[model samples]
Target: MDEVRVFPIIITKNKDSSEYPYFVEIPDIDGMTEGKSIADAMKMAEDYIGTFSLENKLPDSNTKLPRVEEGAVVTLVSVNVSEYKRKNDNRVVKKTISIPNYLNELGKENRINFSEVMTAALKKKLSV
Candidate 1:
């Protein structure tokens, strides 16, 4: 089971031409990132939270929101720590399984990717 947590953030639009368009800051996690659009900013925020979840103790879901500056806009972004770990963690663990010889031959003949197929099956089984 996974618990999703939300973090409060401030977004500042950049008027400079060279730098990224949006600068984001999440005070609770002491995180900051920049993006080119609102969507990118939100995704980066989620990524920052996910990374923080990996490096630190999972904070309480009810953690208080951090105060924002007068000109900055505030928002809450949520990330699923367990889900993020499942998707992003790179340490690999190998598994062994068996399939019908004929099916395996057919897959190989069709150039099917066994690892992709296995991962999809496992993720579906785990409801990930």
Candidate 2:
């Protein structure tokens, strides 16, 4: 069996960019830091946590949150229960995926996710 560990995170507003007013991040650990802001950032954080939780088999338990201080706000975020359950039941893995040369070339040309292109192709192929 593998051991699992959980860490705390902090969110703060950027000093420079007012438009990007929030960040979700774990504290520095061995020099790994991926920061996010705005709605998309939160979503990215969710995906990141999902991956981390899956890899570490984080427990499906409510966190023992600390009491909030003055001038602080707490926002409740939601995730798909089925997705969380699936992550809890599986282990994260690293694997390389293969794509057609044309797909790869087009992705490079467009600077977009190969998955997005693949999804579009599949949709068109199936006449969806």
Worst 10 residues of 2 by lDDT: 26-35
After TM-score superposition, the amount by which residue 71's alpha carbon in candidate 1 deviates from its true location, in angstroms, is 2.4
- List TM-score per model, in order: 0.68, 0.39
lDDT of 2 by residue, 64-97 (tens): 4434545333343344535665645644345467
38 Cα displacement, candidate 2 (Å): 3.9
C-alpha local distance difference test of each model: 0.82, 0.51
Q: Which sections of candidate 2 miss by over 4 Å?
A: 1-10, 17-21, 26-37, 67-73, 81-128
Which pairs of residues collide in candidate 2? none
After superposition, candidate 1 runs with Cα above 4 Å error: 17-19, 98-128
Q: For residues 29-100, could you state the per-residue lDDT of candidate 1 as single tens digits?
A: 678998888778889999988988876986666446557667666788889988998788877678888999
